[model samples]
Target: MSSKKGGKSKFLSEDLNELLNESQFLKDSVSNKKITKRQKNDVTEEESLAKLIGQYQANSKKKKLDVNVEACKESRQKILDVMNNQLETRKEKSNNLLKNLSEVMVQLEVDCNAMKDNEKKLEHLTGAVVKCMQQATTAHRQKLKVLKDIHASFKKQCEEMEMDHKTETDKLAEELEDDIKKLQEKLISETKRSGWENLRRTIFHAMQNDF
Candidate 1:
């Protein structure tokens, strides 16, 4: 989430920088326009003064007019005053623009610093994420190893149990065979006793008499 916010802030910063550049461009254009207007005003005033001088020369040649001389002087003084005032106004305006431009430059520097800081922060976050991922991978690997060991142990236990069962079954079978052998021996001995021999002879004599 922090990473996403950082990305958005970066985008907004870039946009703001672009807007600042456009604003500077517009300000420069406006400053140029003002200078051009000032120049045009000066040229128009000069042309008017030149025409007035020509008219005064023509009138002086045609007749001696005192009132026209005073008017011409006053007109020249007024033109000078207007020119000086306009020059001062232009100079003041240029100074103000320069001051503003300087301030804009400072702001741009600050924004650049801010962008650098944000980039550093992002790099830090990326490194942290990488570290976390590595740790998780390591943990998972360890868990898998543990599980594998457990499985191997279980398999070994199962084999041991089966071997024990086979051993017990073999022991029981041996004991049963021994018991059957002992009983068979006793039966054979009883069948071959002295009483059984006497009975066999009696049965044979009886059979001869009947014949």
Candidate 2:
């Protein structure tokens, strides 16, 4: 009975040793799993940081490109404004030149018209002067003709008066000579009758004395 009691005690001791060995193995496995999970979390955090750095670099490059493009646009706009101003100045100058040319042409036309009017007036004045000269010359010729006619008529009247005076003087001298011859013939006849009467009276007286 003492040997059976010793065998039972040994069996109980072996069971307890087996249970302690299994509990130690389980504790080691749980500690290994916890270390692996912590390593995976650390790797995920590093990848997230690298992605954030790459995004910051790309944003910086895009900002620089945008600034250059804006500067180029502003320069191009300034050049275009200068060109427009120059074109406007040229247009104004061309319009002024055209206006001045038109005014000059109008003045030339007026001067030409005035010259034509002056020529017409001069022609009319010349014609009037010529007509007046011709009339004066004709009047002078008529006056000369009238003076010649008056001189000729006066000479003819003087010659006729001289001839009439000579003819009257000759007729009066012939009548006086005829009257003197008639008076001499009557005186001779009266003297002869008186002598004959005296002789008769002397003879009668002588006869009486004889008786």
Task: Find the candidate with the highest lDDT and give its number.
Answer: 1
**Tell me, what's the RMSD of every candidate?**
68.5, 91.7
Q: On a 0 to 100 scale, what is the lDDT of residue 73 in model 1?
A: 53
TM-score of 1: 0.32
> In model 1, how large is the Cα lDDT of residue 188?
44
Give the CA lDDT, 0 to 100, for residue 145 in model 1.
58
Residue 105 error, candidate 1, Å:
63
Give the clashing residue pairs of candidate 2, or none. Answer: none
| Residue-by-residue lDDT tens digits, candidate 1, 68-155 | 4445456556655665576566556655755665565556556555655565555557777656655655565565556556555655
Residue-pair clashes per candidate: 0, 0
Q: Candidate 2 — which residues are off by over 4 angstroms?
A: 1-39, 125-211
lDDT of 2 at 125: 75
Tens-digit lDDT track for model 2 on 13-89?
45444543543454345447666665565456447644654565456545654565566556555655665565566
